[model samples]
Target chain A: MNSTSAPEPAQPTERIPAAERREQILAAASRVFGERGYSGATTDQVARVAGISQPYVVRMFGTKENLFLEVLARALDRLVTSFRQIIQEPREAGPAATELLASRLGAAYVDLIEDRGILLSLMQAFISGHNPVIGAKARAGFLEIYRMLRDEAGFPPDTIREFLADGMLFNTLLAIRLPDIFHEDPAAAELMRCTFRGKLDVVLDATAAESTDADAAPAPPAAGHVDAAKDDK
Target chain B: MNSTSAPEPAQPTERIPAAERREQILAAASRVFGERGYSGATTDQVARVAGISQPYVVRMFGTKENLFLEVLARALDRLVTSFRQIIQEPREAGPAATELLASRLGAAYVDLIEDRGILLSLMQAFISGHNPVIGAKARAGFLEIYRMLRDEAGFPPDTIREFLADGMLFNTLLAIRLPDIFHEDPAAAELMRCTFRGKLDVVLDATAAESTDADAAPAPPAAGHVDAAKDDK
Candidate 1:
């Protein structure tokens, strides 16, 4: 019901004006869903919050779920922006990177949680079934982020296939979306941060010390098989 | 409606058989919910998966939500058990502890994800509103675990009040429960483990080095203020 009055001018303005309208709609959806939850929220509420009519909202996005998925995508893009900002600022690699990344990721996650917890909750609620639309969109965003980090970590795309980025993505999402779970004991957060730093260091070090000749013949499929098998349930 | 069954004698077993019963119920609930989304699942279905009668399941737990909460508690407890087993072993404090803890936590988290994804989804669904009974139970269980770890970490009973535990719990839960986000990216899991390990080492070292002098001062009012802030949204 929000399509007819969409603020799109079909022409460019000084601000690429469509961007501002999209942001307004996304923010409204995030706030509404975060507060009222996904199933409990309505497109009318989101439209009202966006200062746009319901038909405009429909024009911008077909449905409430669709709007929610778009917002989640934007949130991830924001994280990528933050990560890039951190890396390009000429920070040292060791403890500095660890601490900065922790705090940055923590803040980003907290903000995302407060803004879009309900949408995340909805995604979690329906992630398992065979519904590919929402899952694929979110997964594709995650893979895009991981792909950027692939060269940073020095792993081939084929080998990265055996990994599970979903676990980490969920961890960050849950940390923000479920503050009660994270805020229960302060030590838990500290412990988790330390754990993440240590493991990240291992990956970075392994990548830095990689041997070009190690891939000469395939290095025995059994080695990769055992590694993958152990990782498998 | 389910309480219509006759109440049995409250005879206690050698070690608290009710605990065992709770575990069995949780195990069944885990598999059932993991396979089918919560909305698609029923108490009878859980009972069948658990190999008990539906009435017995209802008599023991008031509702599906209650059963799912129990499963979450069990899952957290399982992770804690592994952590304690490794941490308390007579090993020196250093990188090895960090590595062992990270790898073990990662493995346990992966297992939980594979085994109990559905229960986590259900718990998350009721996290926001209309499920205080379940929320309270889950929060209390989480707080209990957090408090236990805080005491061991040398933080006075009420001194350390960061929801770090809650964040860790939620993050780890998401890590496993939302495999679509983590399954494809192994480095994500590795980075999380390393990060947590690195930060946890700082905490453990501080606790180990804290002398009677540090503990002598009755925690400052600032500490309380900090706790309040920490607990605030």
Candidate 2:
């Protein structure tokens, strides 16, 4: 047992503030829902991943749909923050900078895959357009990012559109689990090699760790928040 | 009542060949599965859409996954045929021809949406990369298309990549039902206007007809094949 200290289960948040605990649950839910998909994932699975009781997950998010909505929102928030960081950074002036920024922006997006659920969860949200609530949020968020790339980032219209296009294809690759099939299929391997480039190892490692994680039992609820980022490695 | 057929209940396809009937069911299943993701679709629903009985659907496809696989294959085949048709057309030997050809290729891909399920079904299949068989098919088919654009269509590497990127984003916009919320959300409306350009009306009308189709009862099993393209209008 990894439990070093056992607090009474009733007051699980005695030390952590409500806001901080919410973040912890969201981080865990992101990975769970992103990996399993919204329909296939359950609140119980989210609780297990978050190292909290099922009732706690239900109490915090109210419903599975609500939990997913929050997770989706967080993923978008992270994306905006990532792009903002890149845009705010100082860079040289010229066509080269614009070109560099586009690739850098793309690399930043691909890097989000290391966070695992952030990009995958967004893909899940993107395709869930039939759902009234999720679909609206996905559209607004997607376009907001588009606007940021165009307006704030000063990317030309065609360049920014291509950037977004690349991002969309990247998401499709992940959704199809291209990394998993790459070794066996050369076509997938070539596509992965081209699309992922240097990040292929990181992508492969993240997904590989997940399959290994599939066998492990849920950590005890008192085990504390599992850092999805580090654990995924 | 739209039904004019007076066939015996047990002999719905008495006049139609089994092979022809298979195509009818696959066509219907493409729409049903494309509109509703694979897990959400049922054999009975597909049968009703195909204007055939449930037993016939089950007999032909054996299972819903099998039915979906056939639909997915048909979608890919259609994609290849459309692209090949574009690629084979006569063109001047110059950069302008390549430029014109790329747009022609994209327009052809977009026109596949007029078939409704063909494009949406491909979208469904693209994201279904989690399934073993479907994922394999999706990757192979997607890459095959990629190679076609690059090799046969004679697009430069970067250009072809963007073409695919645009196509993927196009699929995302459709999957999220961006056309539905274009009127209410300015972000959505703007994005739809830009991404769809001239085809905005076609995209909107297709989704609108789908929502309306949602309310209508399934066609009678003996009423012969329902041309989904015609009904969506």
Candidate 3:
């Protein structure tokens, strides 16, 4: 668990800009909330992960719910942005445009789950739907993704639905870490082999590779891509 | 939320036999733990739901974890039992046996999800996989279902995997109550329409129908069915 937490600072005296600090805190909060979930996570833990004071953590976010709202929003935004970029990219002229788009979009989702925190945090939000604010956000976020796939990506309704269904299966598979648990069981192994088809090794390898470079620089956005403005609602 | 909790007893003083009382408590615990999850659920609430004292609840299960394990075990058992019953039934001759078996087993799964608590509790167990005991139970339970599908039902690896994948998507859709959320939005509604492929109404209607008869008599087991002894592991 400690290993999964953010690394301790080398020198505590270094001061960062407020905007930079906010991003840092949000990143740490994502990991904490992702791991422990919204109800189980604490600002104290988020602060510790961010290498900041607990009071500052609360002061920055105003409340725990507020902090979680920001985390949920950010995770959703990243997903929406990832999908939008894939849709906007130029594609070859062929009868297979829909399949190609679906494949690329699926790959993008697989990449997003590699972050671990992003997908889990979104799932936590969905599960915590008894809270009206969280429930509204989850529903709206889900709808936004659906709309992007259908309207923006121009995929048929059935195609989009199948894509989302496959995505949900992948989410559950990753959430349970089925690969790790079923590696020794033949039937389980065969099930996973069919579930992921040929992409299992690619996803597993990518996730493994990402974990080793825990403190590596963030990848730059693709050229000509613009981050979508946060949906205030 | 209170409405979702077990209804309060009209007369709380009826003394039931210990075995019967244990089953009552387990049923109530399933609902509470399903709705609130393991961390969020409290034994006091389970006691209230069961119309028994908290002390009695604790005495029966020893701990919350134990109670949850029992609930998890029961839910998994019911699911396995449902699938096994479907597989054991005589089917039409020819290559269509596999398709017939898959369809019947799928319907059995859809029926189990109508219990609400059963699927949610099992999902919560999977998400709480960091706990060694819970993790082991969840893995073994999941594998048991997979093995039952493969060995007992004789589904080929790919067919079983796809069936399970579709099941996961259904679980996610049900967990979020997508039909209720998307009813007001056209595009969202279309996506769900394609996702469920005309079966959405059936699932929603069945779930609604089940909630009304919360304390109805349990359905009798099929003839020739033998209850598999609980796996102590």
Candidate 4:
């Protein structure tokens, strides 16, 4: 059989630099930690998802706590960046700045949740507020976003608070996968219709599409293939 | 030593029936599980807080999972019950029914969080939605409240959704203890002022009073003083 068959080609091992690998690991950790929460998740699981060794994951971040902090920080950073981008965009002088800002930021938030991990992970961080370190960071991170909207985005305090209130409610909706329950549960369907103002289908479609993409992606091989070889044995 | 004090009077242990004991345990568990997520809390802590034995705590609820389910159920029940009470109260016939209802319901929620456990526990439960059992209960429990507002209370779907949105944001504020940060963080103070609309002082006072009440309560001795005696040893 070996003699008759053509030799198998060697698989290419893409060499990712340290900075890129760090980003990859943080992204994977966000998803894992978001799903399992801080205490429930482990570095090993993050490593597996990131296709990196457990030791390497720890070495890169120092500890699971540090990794979670980094993930949370990145999530907050992304949120601020999104809001800033929206504020920077040119608009027709129609709606009041506050109203336009609210709508634009609300849509931005809806877009952000398409990633699933980012919003959920930030929520998990907030729920873990009993931990003094995490609690402080969560409070600071939350205020940072609020301050950005108030000062940078030029939204009034009331508008900022209202926007955040709606965002938080949307977080709960996504956390419980309310969109999935909509069709089967009439109240849920009605609530979503009212909450999104007839945009329920759009959000549902976007979420579904993202989930499909996640499912379709093959597991990336380990950086060195060391663990991959061990698994085969 | 006891005999020296004029034959110390007999310390009578008030016999609590199973039903009362169950309620006591649920209340304590709500506080514990609210402070510590599901995975972080233990039956022993609940038992200690309830002045019951660990075995009794487990026996009463059958399992930790069942205890959590009951706690969640009670939280939802309390919310619905509060809203119902508000709806039944005679109105002044001045403000629109929708505005009156919203204000009443909002005040009820603020009062509920005075316990600091009920609202936070419900939020923690919602965040634990990745677990199948919890996810189902959280979804159903949330929908139960929404349906009550819609079918029973006769609020429009839009009003219901908007009410829930504000509620979810309040949950986040309480979860992160924004009231505690209000004085130290100008942004938090502004956010609370805007969100509460000049009612920040009222909430802060209420929250402070509740914390003082919690602090003044005597620690409950475990049943038969088993664990209490062990700690003494």
Estimate the TM-score of every prediction.
Answer: 0.48, 0.80, 0.81, 0.82
| Rank list by TM-score | 4, 3, 2, 1
Name the better of 2 and 3 by lDDT.
2
lDDT of 4 by residue, A71-128 (tens): 9999998988888998888877656867976887888887886665899899888777
Tens digits of per-residue lDDT for model 2, B164-211? 889999998888787877778775676677777788887887777775
Docking class of 3: acceptable
Highest TM-score scorer: 4
Which parts of model 4 are misplaced by more than 4 Å? A1-15, A92-95, A209-233, B1-16, B51-55, B92-95, B209-233
lDDT, candidate 2, equals 0.76
Please identify model 3 stretches exceeding 4 Å from their true place.
A1-13, A205-233, B1-10, B197-199, B206-233
Question: In candidate 1, what are the lDDT values of residues B1-233, reduced to their tens digit?
Answer: 32223222232222337667667667767655543434435676665444445677777988776776666666666756755665466656674654454454454443433344433543443343223454555555544555554554344332222233333333432423323334456754444343334444332242233221211221122223534555434
- lDDT of candidate 3 over B169-211, digit per residue (tens): 6766655656565557786567667656657677667555433
In order, what fnat does every candidate score?
0.01, 0.57, 0.44, 0.72
Native-structure RMSD, model 1: 21.2
Docking class of 1: incorrect
Candidate 1 regions with alpha-carbon error over 4 angstroms: A1-23, A32-60, A85-131, A152-233, B1-25, B32-60, B77-133, B153-233
Q: For candidate 3, lDDT tens digit of each residue in A1-233?
A: 42334344443434779898899788878876765667667777777767676778889999989999999999999999898988899888689989998999888887786665787778767666445677678778888888888789988877876787777767666656566655677765666777777777876675454331222322222224356655334
Q: What is the C-alpha lDDT profile of model 1 across A1-233, one tens digit per residue?
A: 43334343333222337777888778767655544444445677676565555677777887766887776666666667765665455555674554454455444433433343333543442342223465555555645555654554333443233232323333422323323333555644444344344343332233234222211221221223544556433
Lowest lDDT sum, 10 consecutive residues, model 3 chain A, at: A212-221
Give per-candidate clash totals. 54, 0, 0, 0
For candidate 4, give the docking quality class from DockQ: medium
Superposed by TM-score, candidate 2 places the C-alpha of residue B6 at a distance from the truth, in angstroms, of: 20
TM-score of the A-chain for all models? 0.49, 0.84, 0.78, 0.80
